[model samples]
Target: MRIGMIGCGVISQQYLASFDQLPDVQLVAVADLDPARAAAAAEGREGVRALSVDELIADPAVDTILNLTIPAAHADVDLRAIAAGKNVYSEKPFAVTTKEGAEVLVAALAAGVLVGSAPDTVLGTGTQTARAAIDEGLIGSPIAATATMVTPGHERWHPQPDFYYTPGGGPLLDMGPYYLHALVTLLGPVASVIGAASRTRDVRTIGSGPRAGESIPVSTDTHVTGVLVHESGVLSTLVMSFDAVATSAHPIEIHGTEGTLAVPDPNRFSGDVTVHRLGGEGWEPVPTAGGYEEAGRGIGLHDMAVRGPELRASGELGQHALEVMNAVLESAHSGARIEIASHVARPEAVALEDVRAAT
Candidate 1:
């Protein structure tokens, strides 16, 4: 498949490299607000052209458009791609709000085009192995889960990280999707969300970097705490913050009647996944069967480029994640528990031998 990429930022480079390695995929064109940035990104790349966003979307050679713009621009880019009658693969948080996310979904459905988003970490072997273990009843019935993400705000290293402190870019919307998607994958659809959010600091100092000690005014919530009620009666407490110090807590920890599974950080697609039985003395590592040998940084985008439309995490699963994440933010804002309206069916099991063979 031939694809065009919008927003040639740092993450886009990873996508470009992975696409280069996939024999079936081709990077047809690239577009960015800055022509120089887009040209520089496309330079020395084989068989790719630099064009305006409209021109790239209109290109007959491109079958799909990868939306890599900032959080606020996601919906607009997706809507334009849908109007152009092209499949779209977007970055995480689908949109800033539930209403915007729903609109993107509606447009995709109406246009008969496929739409996928990032945080496809579930497609990685780490998550798939965990899923297999759960399906085998190794963990018994899941009862509760907890996810935490704490970091010193983003003004430290990102060349253009100012947007992260603004309205459409906070802990809940910025880093929540990874954990939320993992929750939905391991558990089921979230039935309701009760949350509280706050802006802990009016201004944050860049901790470490060349821009160290720089001050950035914060406009969005820096800390968020929520309880997510899944359809299976599993309660998940989610905590995300940009104002707190780091901790030893795993990104995700699920407690089942039989045992507790310690999942790797959701920010990464591959890592060591361990499980500890209720009475076990120590954690036992679960070995991965084979799939993508080297987990690409953007595993979701890589999988979509290489595996085509059949990839598990690229379709309804992504949409479901977006819906749940948006619901969480809405719950925090409205001071009411928000119920998710969208549903994603569980994916069918794939044979381990099949995955091994694919590699």
Candidate 2:
């Protein structure tokens, strides 16, 4: 597959490396609003040519277009790629709103092209091992889940982090996808959501980087809490914050009738997983058979290496997560529990022996 990258930012480096490692994929071209940035990313890359967004999408040589643009531009770029009859693999928070994500999905379906989004972290070792254990009935029937993320703000290292406080880059849209994807992967589609959100501080001071000590006015909600009712009757409490501090806790925990499974942070691809049985006094770590040692590369590469298909942790999961998170925000805004319109079934489990046989 000839892949064209739309944005050449920090995350794009991971995509570039993963695509380069794949024997079936070729990084044919790249596009960025900043010509210099695009040129820099294309440097030393074989067969990579920097082009304008339009040119890259319209190019017949490219089979897939990776949409790595900022959150606000996701829908527009995806629509264009679909119109050009190209498959799309986009970054997380597929769009600023579920409505926009729906439009993109419709376009891709009409165009007869596959559309997927990031937060493919589920394909990572941490979430994948958890899924395997759940499939084996190690945790039995999940009854509840909780995910918490508290960050000081991205102004620290991001060269252009101002957009993070904007609508498309808030905590719910930005970091919510990872945890939400893991939840949906472990459980199933969320049936309803009730949420509350607020901006604790009007401005924040940058903690590090060249912008250190600089004040940034916040425009979007920085603190959000939501209760998600899954179709499987699992109630999940999700919390995100930019104004507070949090102690060490598994980013996600799923409680089941037979046992409780504690998953590592969902932000990265691979980590340790533990399960505490109903009668057990302490948590016991579940040994992972096919876990990756690296972080971001694990999920994407594992999907490609193990499944021989892109859907493993591919862009599709990211799009689904985007819809779920947007539903939470919408529910918060209307002061009512909102039901997500999209339905994403939990993936079927693949046996480790089968995976080994294929390998």
| lDDT tens readout by residue for model 1, 50-127 | 999999989999888889999899989989988999888888777776678788878888988777787766666666
TM-score of 1: 0.92
Count the clashes in each prediction: 0, 4
The TM-score measured for candidate 2 stands at: 0.91
lDDT per model, in order? 0.78, 0.78
Q: Count steric clashes of candidate 1.
A: 0
Off by over 4 Å in 2: 290-310, 314-316, 350-359
For 42-112, candidate 2 gives per-residue lDDT tens digits of 99987899999889999999988888899999999999899889888778788887778888988877887
